[model samples]
Target: MSDTSLLSSLLNLITTATCNLQSELKGAGLPEPWIDNASLHPWDEETPSKKYWDARRTLISALGMMTAVVQNPREKIICDDLGYHHSAALNFIVNTHMADVLAAPNVDERIGLPVSEIARRTGTHPAKTERVLRFLCMYHTFQETSPGVFANNKVSECLKKGHPTAELPLMWADVGFRSATAFSATLRDPQTAHSMRIEDAPFGAVFGNHTSKSTSESESIPKSEPGTASPVRATIFEFLSRPESEVYRSAFAKTMVTLDIMNGALGYHDLPWDRWDKEGAVFVEAGASTGHLSNDVLSVVKHAKFINQDLPEVCLQGEKFFAENNAEAIRSGRVKFQPNDFFTEQPVKGAAIYILSNILHDWPDNEALKILKHIGDAMIPTSRLLVMEIVIVPSLSQSRSPPSAPVDQNPNDAPWPLPKDYGIVNRYPHHQSMEMINTFNGLDRTLDEYVALFQQSELELVEVHRIRKLVSIMEVKKKA
Candidate 1:
């Protein structure tokens, strides 16, 4: 439709609403400026009449106000909610198990299977499965790259088990199972919603071991084999394995990768490698693991040495990844990987360009300061440090296309009686991100937060860039 027609339609809708309200108020027998002045615009409340235009004014106000409210939103959630279920939504999440179905590595189109086939393969009901799949595509949860098939989104990718989007789903799924089996609420709180908080948990409360409850009712079952152990026992064994299990270690790596991604991780693939000097300065990535992007940097900055460093476990992963890559690279001879603990008092020398990716948010004020001081001490007086982290915007109120929901809590909930910065109230991400970080000793910081963190670390921000559009990259130099 043309703009003129669209405008005419809207004008008609408004005219009808206004006229209806005017008639209702006139009938209410209210004697007021409303009745006397048909010419008075809604805003002209300056002159009052014997009967204040209460009814007409209020009704018109609502009509006018709703316009502003409606126009503010980006996407209108369909009034009839989609029949999409939890797993249906999750399975559509990026890079997780679900991707295996809707898409294979090479074929990006719809899997061309009937509902029965899809259900049989995924173990879902035919009709319901088809409905959910089609429904998510409606909201762009996944795109129907081909008819009856789906592709990913930044939104969905952001929700992967490793992303901020991954937390609530994972947390609720794990705890929700326990709640269901509670069968009748063995405890109290018969009236209110169940409230429990898991904090500082990276990767959004994967529960160190998030798995389903045992279906086998064999209560007296003993450890016939450790592999057959119950979930609780398996959890205990995971802990017993202590940072060694591939699962636990993967969770750790996944969490950092997600954090870095959220904090605007800029991979080596995205860098202007053709322009960067290979030997200009070796890029030392502190806490780099698997060298996923660091290796890309090495490839790009051929003259620049790429150093990927992290803890022993991550170092091993990096070494393994590099070694695997090296088997191919050695034939071509490029890029090197080094293993070192940043915390073990190694002098930060020779590295002209140091990178800290998604590191500061994990520590509290004092500890973060200590790490910064270590970086400061190790840095050459003139060296530069590139620190990447999420800078909390003071009020997320503006971020909302239509603004936040009424129940949405304020970001700055005013910590006690202290000043905002002193209280650190604003450094928090949304409650969703907070839950994941709080499960562990991690946090999301603001610009002021980055400054405070940087000052402590003996680095001063020279310029800050919002990389990948979302992650804040701080170019810092040693404090003069």
Candidate 2:
């Protein structure tokens, strides 16, 4: 396409998408969202219809495309290089609880709070806080009402401590930023490069406390075998358990909640709970942390018994959580907690449905295969395994292979000029894919990569259900 043609196409897409979005919002009686608006977007309260989602995808894609086309490549590269400052600023704001002070009961959203008062309330250096806030203001997050005063805008409201996504920034800014700084080192290191061990990931370079294994011990270990004693080391979770890491641990918990929120409630609602809620039905959740996912599933599958499995410590927490919040389910034996390692042999066999929600993506293919194999081994002819995680779309690929099992309508399809993966709409998943590499030497898999894993594990890819923008439910079973 010619330059003018490309620009015109992008402009047309933006205009059309924006119009559709406005129409959908008006039809739903939602206030049009603006960056300055302090109120939550309607989508936060209710899942958007397909029309709204499609419009959003197209709008974001076209805007990103237009920016890429217009911006000077050299400046764009420089901007990308300085992106760490974005993380640094976000870290400072979140750590100092500046958003909390800005959104305080006494604070005026319009007049705003002075930088000095914000620093005083949050125990931060006033000058440094102002500089950070100013940097963020350039990006239209928190707004500067006056020279030295800042206030909560719609974008910044999510940074408030009580907000659903508050911890998301800290998760990336503090932990993710530190880990990513060692990315090049991990790739360049002769010993760590080409290694799939979790301890060899970029995060290990930054915060590794694992004891070095001896040559004899390392040689005895089988390649990609997870439970073996070679390269004995603590994973990120173990590191978070330290007393000094309590703040990070708390942030990590809230970050998980943020992720669940981002995945949207519709993903859970669209599952075939009614079909799975039959008499004598069993649902096993592998690597289930504190039964949050089991709680979600149990809400719909009332008659189905649940076995939530994780490490022993996590199971203890799950027990307490269920006792306090779901006493009836616990008493009636509708929900049960079992301490089990997913890397080990399968314990709960012949389950009606086995769910590995957000689990396999934490490991590389070799490790992920082991996880699938265990579930495959335990599955009966009628069993269904749901691997629910981000199923990444290939940007350059043109193939739109039809799914095997039932599928809900998806709004991810992009037209000409837009990449097959929908460009900017897939940014989060790509970012997450990178995070998996930095944190666990893992990755978010493409659909093809997932199929390869399933085939190797003697499991068949039954179908895919794109439940949310970044999440999919891939149904699988033992190869027939």
Candidate 3:
């Protein structure tokens, strides 16, 4: 189809998807998302009907692709590729706590706050604050009620302190933005480009000072197998584990909590936790950070004894978290926090279920294979391993779209064909894979790669429970 025809078809798709999404929300009795007076809602809070959310996601994907399709070639190449400007603006807004300023109780939410007042409260120059806020407002992050005055929209409210996702902006603006600056350079450098070691990653190149002392010592740590060196180096976790890195570490932890709120809790929802409803059945959460996943499991799977394991510092934090949030579970001995390194042999043996949630993607194949092996060594005949992670799917490229066909030829299909990278199903996993690469020379794996890793540990892929978009619960068992 001609560019004009394609653009018209995309516009039609956007219109149709928007109408469907609105109808779904109305049917479900949920408020329509409005930029002017948006409210921040947690994922689990008054969860919308599945149909409504599915329509919402479809609408977003259609709108995004439509915008991409309509952009002129030069505009797409020049504007879409730019990032430094966005990073700088986001860094300014996050660092200055502009969202917090707008969310202040003293300020009238309806009237909003002027840039001068926000700048005064944040100790920033008014002009610079106005410029950045305006940029963000254009993208619907915040709302400009009138010229120079801004209010917190749903997106901006997420940046407020203590919100589940508040630290996300800060984490991305500080660590991710800085690391991304060196991404091209890291890829071009011969020594770093081909290396799977974390120290060779873009984050390591930019934030080298944060490297942990233990990482150097780990060079002497024996490899899991002979004739192969462990793909070990000072990873992002090591950097954050340092005493001086407490602030960044806290932000990172909160970021993980945000992810748990969004995707991790879904693990509890459509699974057969009832299978282990019998008393004394053990459930181990390996590499548990702050025990969020364990908490989710304990909330529903009452009969199981929970073991939340992580590194020394994370376990200490997890203990405090459980003490404060899940006091009864701790008091009753139903839940316990253990300091354990996953690289070492599993200390907890023969658990009914071992959950490795969002863990293996932090390492290369060699190290990931070793982690699986360690878990396998600890498993009994009936023990199961549940790996909760994204299974990256191969996406179709837009360049490979079928030859000029009439838009009406496929009435069964939407007026505009869904792009190869349509929806969060494809976008999120791909972005996360790139994030893994930037931070630790790791990657989100495809189903084939996961199956291969399972085989290397003498385990077989038993089942795959797709618990959420972009994430799946890959069940594995010892090979017969």
Candidate 4:
């Protein structure tokens, strides 16, 4: 295809997708979400129908491609260089509570808060605050109603103090920013590049392990098996548990809550909960921090009991959370907290279902194998292990049309002009795949990779249920 023809094809795709999305919204009697509005669109407040979701995904995918194709190559490369600057500016805005100041009840949305006032409230320099707001304004985050004055727009409102997505920016900036900046260095360094050890990840490269004990002193800690990269120091999880890292630990916990809200609770909807609904059914969630997933599950599987297992400290926190938020479940003995390490033997044998949500991706194949083996050892013939994770579909594929989704299937195929798996619309898994590498020297895997890993652990992948666009329930059982 000629360059001009390809460009036209892209434009046509964008137009068609946009029209479809708009028509769906209008048909549903919903207002189209606008970037400039401070209030969330009605659709944002609730889940949309499947048709609406498909249309919206199509539009977003096409638009993302159109953006890349239209921008000059040189300009795109230059702009990409300042990705770090964008992160830094956003970090500054969030850390200084700029969004909170602008969204305060007394603050006028039209007039906006002056940079001086915002700076005073946040204890920052006025001139510096203005520059950060202006930079963010260019990206349609905060809006500048007048020179040196800013207010929360739809994009910025999510970062307000108590908003659902407020901790996302904080988490990404504090946990990921430096690691991302040091990506090249970590990969280029011979010591870390080929290493599969979690301790050798970009986080460790940027900020060497903070734990005081040496590797020799910490023999009780889990070590990589032969052929796996050995730990040079403590991993991020261990560091987060230290008494001195209390502030970061608190922030990390809140960040995870925001992460859950962003990921939604629908990922568990498609699983075969009915089959296990008999009385005395047990669901054990490994590495379950604060038991949020299990709590959500309690609402769905009324007859099943849930046990949330995690580190001792996190188990304590989960107990408090259950007491305050799900007292009835705890009081009724339907939900319980167990402090246990997944690396050790499986304590609760023959649970009806076991869940390892977003846990395996935090370790490499070798370490992940150990985790799987432990879980597999405890599984009976009827016991099922649901590995809730992203099963990465390639962004580019041979299919030129959306793959057919049978009543029982959730195909991720994309149409022509938009790469398969909906291109940038499906970047969450890819971004998270890199995040795993950056933070833990781990990675997200394709279905084939998972199948191979499960086989090695003496488990079989019996079924797959794509629950959300970015998450799937890989149902496995003990090998026959």
Top of the candidates by lDDT: 2
By lDDT rank, best first, the candidates go: 2, 4, 3, 1
Better candidate by lDDT, 3 or 4: 4
Q: Identify the runs in model 1 with alpha carbons over 4 angstroms from their true place.
A: 1-68, 71-88, 91-98, 104-111, 142-245, 251-280, 323-334, 396-432
Better of 3 and 4 by TM-score: 4
**lDDT of candidate 4 over 1-480, digit per residue (tens):** 223455676778778877887888989988888877887776665446556667778888878887887889999999988778887787677667787888788988867898899989998999988888899999999888988888888888777876647665655666676567567777877767898888888777654544433221232322222223444555688777788666566566666655664635654655669987778889999998888888766767978899999988888888897888889989999989998999999899999999998899899999999999999999999999999887787666434433344443335566665776888887777888888888888989999999999999999998988654367889999999
TM-score, candidate 4, is 0.88
- Flag the better candidate by lDDT, 1 or 2: 2
lDDT value for model 1: 0.48
Task: Encode model 2's per-residue lDDT on 208-317: one tens digit a residue.
Answer: 65332222123232123222233445567667777767666656766765676674566587777786688999999998777777776566676789999988877887
Per-model RMSD to reference: 16.8, 6.8, 6.2, 5.7
Please, what are the lDDT tens digits per residue for candidate 1 over residues 342-423?
A: 6656444757677777666655566667667767777776577777665666541222122235455343332111222222
> What's the TM-score of every candidate structure?
0.55, 0.87, 0.87, 0.88
lDDT of 2 at 52: 89
| Candidate lDDT values, in order | 0.48, 0.78, 0.74, 0.77
Name the best candidate (by TM-score): 4
* Total clashing pairs for each candidate: 18, 0, 1, 0
Query: What value does the lDDT take at residue 56 in candidate 1?
Result: 36
